[model samples]
Target: MNAFIYFPVYLVLKSEEEYAVYYLPTDFQSPELFVPRKPLSDQAKRAGWQGFLYDLSKVPQGAFIRIV
Candidate 1:
């Protein structure tokens, strides 16, 4: 079976800190990223960036022995 999904990316940053991170996609087929914090929050906004296409096929398949 083949499955695909859109993975939203976010720009997390503080006053002087910044880095790219992965966010979750909304159920409506569109992702909504919200940043709520201190002064940094003001600058934190949707980067309007596109998510990369992740291919699960590249991952090695293994037996699931544990689930928690």
Candidate 2:
């Protein structure tokens, strides 16, 4: 049998928008660059870092949310 695992991701784009939410696969090296290529979700700030956790995934992909 084959096993599968998924990691949820929350990230911020370089534009005016805040961040994006998606899922990433875990068994192999991801070919995607974590770029928001299309229409991103509307900005909604949860209280005190809520919802999914993307800490590890963010570091390698470098999807940190910077306020500019």
Candidate with maximal lDDT? 2
Worst 10-residue lDDT window for candidate 2 reads: 46-55
Which runs of model 2 end up more than 4 angstroms from their true locations?
A: 16-68
Question: Model 2 over residues 21-53: C-alpha lDDT tens digits?
Answer: 443335422433333333334563433433322
* Model 1 CA deviation exceeding 4 Å by range: 1-48, 63-68
- In the predicted model 2, the residue pairs found to clash are none
Q: What is the lDDT of candidate 2?
A: 0.38
How many clashing residue pairs appear in each of the predictions shown? 0, 0
Model 1 pairs in collision: none
**lDDT (10s digit) by residue, model 1, range 1-68:** 01435433332434555444433233323212222233433444754433344332432343112221
Q: Please report the TM-score between candidate 2 and the true structure.
A: 0.18
